[model samples]
Target chain A: MNDSPVLRVRNLTRRFAAGVVLKSLDLTIERGEFVALLGRSGSGKTTLLRTLAGLDEVSEGDVQVSPESTVVYQEPRLFPWKRVWHNVALGVRTPDARRRAEAALGEVELAHRLNAWPLTLSGGEAQRVALARALIREPELLLLDEPFASLDALTRTRMQGLVGDLWARHRPAVLLVTHDIDEALLLADRVLVLSEGRLEADLRVDLPRPRDDGETRFVHLRRTLRTALGVTDKQAIAA
Target chain B: MLDAVLAQGSRIGLGGNARTTTGQVAPRPRRALHLHLGSMRRLVSPLLLLAVWQAASSTGLVSAQTLASPLQIMLTARDLLNDGTLTHNLAVSLVRAGVGLGLAIVIGVSLALVAGLSRIGEDLVDAPIQMLRTIPVLALVPMFILWFGIGEMPKILLVTLGATFPIYLNLYKGIRAIDPKLLEAARTLGLTHGETVRHVILPGALPDLLVGLRFSVGISWLMLVVAEQVNANAGIGHMMMDAEDFLRTDIILVGMLVYALFGLASDQGVRLLERRLLVWRPQAHRRG
Candidate 1:
């Protein structure tokens, strides 16, 4: 992998009509790095993700990212009218597009759903198709916007495993914006907590791959992130 | 949230239906015998109503002059069929409706595309159309007759005018109602403007267009009825008008039956088209 940063945002700021959502925020994501952003609701996590995905405008400062990047949203956003394979192959230009689609779907374990309509797929299956679509682009940067947040506990855990596996294989620079502390530690190389407009915490994990929630360091980091987000131990226990 | 809901919903729907192929509307697999029996049960009331009408007419409880018996109407229909008056007039009426509806689809869809896609286009096309659509277009037949001289032109024009609004209104609304998230997805996927319109905008808007088409076709027939009543023409309405001069209620009733049959048949045709075109919508497969 290249040593250069895949994304660089220097004193980036974004404002809406109501007020400033992000003010003088600076961050950099190196190529092949995995970063998980944890933030409370309405803490401009969405605004930052949108800015990274090129879906929103920057009102101030420099924001530079690799042109070859894609996002997998919390929702699948698959076209209900399109078949699974076709949804994955959309805008893909290749002489062997069908073969590529089949291969991509195979990665997501949706090979059996090649001709199945998107609406026919269950929620987990649909999100898998969304993953296949993003991966087909062979992006340098992958932005996952809480892709498993809505899934039931079993499905969410399975999806998290799948995402980690895919990341291992592709080694794309991934920025996962999520609320789950356990999820962040399990997947990311670095954990950043965005409270208000600024990133308040940038903790690097030195743990090995497939880190367990039961591990001592994992528990310590989880408690630290919770504190950074202003959650007391008693309050966290009550919840 | 939509993903979570759809996942849960589909998981529930997938129980015992994993073997079924995609997007066909039975939430559960239906047995063939049950389907046939269900259809038969639903048909009972309509057949019973027909039987009651036929019985009242056969016993001479209702006079032929006041109201033709179903038997008399059937006999008159056979006579008209044998002599080819019914065939020729029916053929003429079909041509008018078909041609008028064809034109309406073309004009309405083009206008809707123009108005629905852009702000400038909406500004240019929507105002005049909104004003024109408010005026019950069947009321324009007299003016159309004067301008176009009560020939095929005026009749076809009336049908075209009457049929256009529903398609325009429904399709325009469909365009506006497309999920914005899908468009955002399309943009990220790198679809060009034309490609986005073709794949995303068109398919997304089609359900409404079909809804409009059903109304437009029904409106076309209504307009044709009025159009044929006005002048020297070869149509089902003209045949009915001639029967009135000779006080042939049986032939007039036959004409009315022909109109009703065609109306029902055309509506069924649109419904079939809906089933085929919108196979993606699970609701389209439901009996209701």
Candidate 2:
């Protein structure tokens, strides 16, 4: 299986002025693995993602993350002034960076939008550009902070498929922070539920690619995760 | 190859759609013409008021001594133009304004960068500036005269005082108001501090800095009027003061008109610059 941990954390503790958000957490993400961390709001999924992305200082932790790591935030977080190609080339210093950015955008089917402004793009398109920007860096570990949360359902589904295809092609270790159980199940090889500042459940999906909702195992896994996250039928229906 | 074919197909489709739409875009010209007339419509009221003033003076209801008719003011302007007084004084006033406003932009932008980018600079520079802004610059004119004497120095200094605060305050606010998310993203991209400031902070603050510049330009002219009035050898204020001594209200009115014309011209100049520089802003908001 060629198992090697790309990210390792032991007793990872994060504290803000309010109090500790992540408490004595332990996690290991393997190279080329797709892991989804599911949590209800305020379960500190974002804090963990930030820590992994080197955005936040953890209070106490022994963390070993790959140097080549990038984060895609909830918002596109694109520089509004820069064109799409320019933004994709933002981290690259080479003279051929623009050509590389255009090629990356081609992979995301956004080659036509190279000269377009970020403000002019739709939510899904902007997120795709953000994905392109991250992928251009060729990060060993790609952290996503609910990158599709703001997208419409149809667009979100399309983006999920695109991400799946990209992951298969590029094979980067991905840790996606999402609250949607179906999204986690759809994209991840492993799903871990976070609660009380700890990972309460870690389950592996033995399902094949292009997972179907009609599958009995998929529904069963969904129900199990829904229960694990304390999402009652009423709550789930309302959501 | 199929992707390229699809892209080319979409481009052709878009071009065809644009061409078809262009034929149906007939109302735009009429609407634009209406907008043009709407702006020209503003001139009617002022023109009517000028007509009434000229009529009242001609009818002897308003005496020439009390108010010069628009025609008399025009004649006075012509005489000043012929004698070279108008151009010479205008050039002098413009020079003073240019020098003062230039110094203000340099000093105010420097201070704003310091205060905006660092806490220590803010604590050291912002308090004194806020204090100075409260005391009107005109009130400081007498103190300036007593300290520096009634020369070109005091006039230029007064203009500098008037122009500095708006540029500093607006630019400082602009710098502080930049999106922290953008900064975070830039840092994640491995941009150094200098690169971040150049690529993000300064460009983000530019819109507000331009607004400050518009105000500063207006203030420079106003302070020049006041400062030149104090004790001037040349400029519009000196011209007006001399006309006051001779009781040539026509020439005085001419000087005031020249000031108004210059104010309008400079303001329009700033608006043009704003349009050129801020084309990234939405179209409707970019209009002068």
Candidate 3:
């Protein structure tokens, strides 16, 4: 039971009326593993994340996600009508919700804004609230779909640290979908490159935590991933 | 796919409304200076018009038969109040409008919930309502009287029918316009369909629902007046018709004034409700 993977997908495929967006993709994430999926725009990056998040139909695949899996979307997606704590505790419809939500917001360091509405929150603060909402669900497979793609540089760095710290504390199998190369290297246990509806490279990032740009291995891994992402679709498919 | 596109379009539109109000067009000190004058400014034209009309009537430039002077109308209003005719008739109109508006709301909101929340429900409910809506509702009045006679039934039914569409259409549009990303988030959060309706769909649609209700209230009064004009036993409309027979234009003006005040007061009431319900919105309760 302990050795079982948290998420397993076999031959996943998603096709819209226009064309196939994901083509027989296979992925597995072990318990407590942190993996980052990186790709350029229109490279099936969001399509794959959405599929694993179960937002779309798995037209031709077998997917087995651990129960209580949840997604943090690119936008905060907080209900503008609801208060901060209500947004966090929305899924947990049980007694003592206030306490659990308070604790979760505390984890995200947003306890001070417990009653604040989503519209009043700054971008970084709202994203942290989103993180708190995701955490409150206690999801075994926490999917992050470009969650920090909109923040400023300074706020993005701080949010990265917060996400990293949360992942360390919770030990959930995290799949962060992003386009930022350094962001992928700075956080994930493994980094995967997806393009043309298929993952082209899955590199294991065994470097130590807080892996900075000065390390030789980090530079080499970043270069390889950049090449993998930069290559034309035909070359990627051929390789 | 179309729904997703429309949802994003609505998100962009809502972004325009969500702009910060503090540093927008008007400066604070300038706005503060006009604070009292701003409201007085609104009353300026109406009061000036009233003064001109009173001057004309007092000088007998406009005959009393053609139009009652404002002073004479006020004196008539006092007589009606003292005799209790105005109070009784006003109560009658109030009950009719209130009951009709309330019933219309229950019916409208239920139908909107059914049609908005389910595809099958939309298929079942939307077509008939749409077909019924295009026909001018006032045209149904003759048929309503033929069917139910010149009784309270037809009056209430007419008001209900007239007011129902705005509520249904606005609320239906609101539900359809909900951002798909929010729905997707709800689903991933493990919300059941019922839970989603309760927590997200209803609240998301509330702003539009209130807008519909305001329209309905206005329409309800208009319908009530029409219904009463036909054969009202006792209502403000009945008082006006009676005054028409006697050529007592002052009483007619009194009835008109009551209806006008009712319209203004009720609209303010709905606005108050809006402010209370939409407390999350920054500009919901803002006053000029």
For every prediction, compared with the true complex, DockQ reads: 0.56, 0.35, 0.72
Model 3 over residues A1-239: C-alpha lDDT tens digits?
47899899999888888898888989999999999999989989888877778787776889988876899888999999999999999969779888999999999999899999888899999999999999988888899999999999999999999999999999889999998888999999999998988989999999998879779999888888979988544665595
Fraction of true inter-chain Cα contacts (below 8 Å) kept per model? Answer: 0.41, 0.27, 0.70
* Ranking 1 against 2 by DockQ, winner: 1
Query: Tens-digit lDDT track for model 1 on B1-288?
Result: 423432342233213121122235554545667887888999999889878878887887877667787778999999999999999999999999999999999998999999999999999998999888656675676789789997899998888887787788778878877899999888887777887898899999887787778777777777787788889469999999998888788999999999889989998998788778876665653533
Writing each residue's lDDT as its tens digit, candidate 2 over B1-288 gives 423433343233222221122222233678989978997998899999999999999999998778889999999899899999999999999999999999999998999999999999999999998777756567788899999899889998888877888788878888888999888877666677988898789978887787777778877887888888889989999999988888788988998898888889997887678667755544412242
Which candidate would rank higher by DockQ, 2 or 3? 3
Write candidate 1's Cα lDDT for A52-75 as tens digits: 888888779999988888999999
Per-candidate TM equals 0.91, 0.90, 0.92
Residues A1-239 of candidate 2 have per-residue lDDT tens digits of 44668899999988889987888999999999999999999999988887887777766979888887888888998877678898899868788999999999999999999998787789999999999999998888889889999999999999999999999999999999999898999999999999978999999998998999779999999999999999888998997
What is the number of backbone collisions in each predicted candidate, taken in the order shown? 1, 0, 0
Instruction: Indicate the residue-level lDDT of A53 in model 1.
Output: 87
Off by over 4 Å in 1: A1-3, B1-61, B283-288
Best by DockQ: 3
- Give the clashing pairs for model 3: none
TM-score between model 1 and native: 0.91
Q: Report the lDDT of model 3 for residue B235.
A: 96
